[model samples]
Target: MAITSIFNDAFVLTWDFILTIVDAVTPSHPAGHVVPAGHPGAGGEWPEYVSPGEGDSRCACPMLNAMANHGILPHDGKNISFKTMNETIRSTYNFSPSFCYFVPNYIARALDKDYFKDTFDLEQISVRNDKGIEHDASLTREDVRFQPDQGKPHIPFINELLATASGKDTSAEDPENALMLTSDDLARYSAKRRTDLENIGGKLDFIHKMFGSSNSATLLRIVGGHVSDLRPFLIDERIPDKWEPAIRSRVGLTMARFNLTVLPLEFSTRKHMKALAKAKKSG
Candidate 1:
């Protein structure tokens, strides 16, 4: 009986050791999807783009939608864990680790999701609220009051902004006709959008205006303010083929760097608004 008891204890210990080894080898969250070969994060080719189908969720943010379209996020746009978002954004865009974490946490808090464990469906971020990320006068979205389906791209509005690009660069060797949007172009476009929305009795409060400014700054920083690069992402909700972030740094685009970019735009936006106001007052 003593020998039998000793053997049972030994077996139990062996089984526990095996289980620990298995746990160590397994991933906490299985991807459950095919990562393309040689992809950045999990190693694979860039996933093919697919439009969101009926009952598949989408958000007002074009960046997230583009990521989902390319299977960087879940293609179905459902139950996206914050950790998954952080990892993918950092790998895909080479954004700062801190910024990547900050965005997801900000969304979770704004949308009232469980910051620690709650997963967000893409559509949840589309909710229009004062605190929510989606707001009026978006670069790729129509005002909430004007458009019933704010999740989809607003092509005409986007084209209008694209037309504001300074002009094609004759100096570039490759992509012979590369168009660039300057800081001035973005500021003017942002100011014009605000005024146009106001004319139509659309609401774009200070918070929303700041959000729009931040997005403009992100666009410039990530894609180098190139109209060619912006087109596919803004209009088609697809990442440009072979896209690499223009901002290359070990720390990536940090919050301080991002803020520095945003401040000038904010100042420019204010300047444009004042000019418009003065013109109107004089007229």
Candidate 2:
């Protein structure tokens, strides 16, 4: 069964999914800031030894596609072992993005927890700070970690095998499938983009301000500003004059009620349902 199907049900809200998300977003850099660099074409000759085209491939990782081709990764996307998977990934590239480190681990844990019915005990460790006071940090067999290399950057490798297997495209571009969006499509995309930014900025800016400053907030501000630039192009007399503010207000209301405004509605609802289920079970 697909990982999504396993976790999609309200009754199936396992800790595995939440833990995987946590592991995925965790900083992989040695300094715990900035995503390490590596794009698709830099690492290896992914889909048969060839050269990168005019621009970088928009695909996630060629190495991952190569893994799927070689049968080192499971065809069914289940029954993965982190030790085995990590060794393969490490051997493939000398260095990669921090986010790439734990994705396979996350997939392995998700598959084990949901389909294979495996269990693990969290281990505790103590470490002393500069003040010489000790704090506890939980340890696990599976974890997110950084593999740093001061070299060329690459694209973050996503766990595509966990989702579905697709035919490896050796060519740089899939000519048959490469149709750019039209002007109207761009307009709609821009409108949606503007609304999303305003929502995210209005809701999170206050909290981010409270915490002083963060890379996350800075990035949001940058992206939000860019989206704001596209506002006039995307909206006009056809759209409501108050459309932007109204959308932001709706986002704030949703955030206040549910503590989420950025995620897609289906995903947010499912996440909330899962959290409620977890709370009820613990209570």
Candidate 3:
């Protein structure tokens, strides 16, 4: 396992170096036009939801899948260019222009594709290698050890996540109700998932753990901070009706802002997991 991890790290580093060179030489694509929120071209109202059918490509990432389902991305999930992905994500989610580019660049490096010329199919992002972007102990998908097909949602796990909000103050009458998962709630849940995977001999490495943490933070920040809003997005891979971008800013969410949210959550999750393991050992 140690040797494999080392190899994976080296491979990832090499890919990153290669991509840096390619990106340096590649001319930037013109910024795609942004449609106004709530307009026909924007993800707000007009685009009808369509379920992915036979031969349609899908991926392990729920957000991307949901985008494809909502027609914010190609319904067929094929031949997606970085420029298209960047514009769509920015317009739909209100992510910063830099963040929009950052994600596609990361995906390109992870999937070993050229960021400039090569278009990617969604299924290409589902590579199960340990160093790849897709990892085990996902919030809504079973680990690859148990289910090779990680592209589909795991209903049981989604149910477990929703259960965290069950007893909270979800009163519809109160506008400022506490129906959402707090940072601690999300951290505890993430710790539990990590522990469960470890007990089953499916421990995640540092890269995978960081990826999981980023996913959680993205859910908390980008997706509606409420668990109720997350339900359809996770279970059905559908964007909720009347959904609006949670964070609205001209600059949008930058890498620094995202890391500020993720780092503390990751630390808290690790601390909780350590406590759980210590308690188990003492018992």
Please give the lDDT score for candidate 3: 0.75
Local error of candidate 3 at residue 118 (angstroms): 0.7
**What lDDT score goes with residue 245 in model 3?**
62
Error of 1 at 160 (Å): 0.7
Which regions of candidate 3 are displaced past 4 Å? 1-43, 166-178
- The 10-residue segment of model 2 with minimum total lDDT is 135-144
> Which 10-residue span in candidate 1 carries the lowest summed lDDT?
28-37
Model 1 spans > 4 angstroms off: 1-45, 167-171, 175-177
Ranking by lDDT: 3, 1, 2
lDDT of 1 by residue, 1-283 (tens): 3475457446544654454455445543322222223554333245788988888788888888888998889889999998898878877765666677667866876777765799989888887766687777677788777786777889998999989999566766777348888888889988887777767777667777778888898788876777888998899888776666666554456665677788899889889978887888899
Q: lDDT by residue for model 3 over 1-283, one digit each (tens)? A: 3575467556645654554455445553323323354643454463777888998899899988988998778899999998888888887776666667767877777777777788999888888665378887788888877888667899998888877763354555665445776667778888999999889878878888888888888877787567767888888888766666666444556666677788999999999999999999999
* Clash counts for the predictions, in order: 7, 7, 0
lDDT score for residue 91 of model 2: 37
Candidate 2 ranges with C-alpha deviation above 4 Å = 1-66, 75-78, 93-101, 108-283
Which of candidates 2 and 3 is the stronger one according to TM-score?
Answer: 3
The alpha-carbon lDDT assigned to residue 97 of candidate 2 equals 19
Give the Cα error of residue 44 in candidate 1, in Å.
11
All models, RMSD in angstroms? 13.1, 21.5, 7.5
For residues 6-50, write the lDDT of model 2, one tens digit per residue.
554322234334433554555432321121134222222222322
Report the alpha-carbon TM-score of model 2 versus the true structure: 0.21
Candidate 1 versus the native: TM-score?
0.81
* Model 2: number of backbone collisions: 7
Error of 2 at 282 (Å): 48
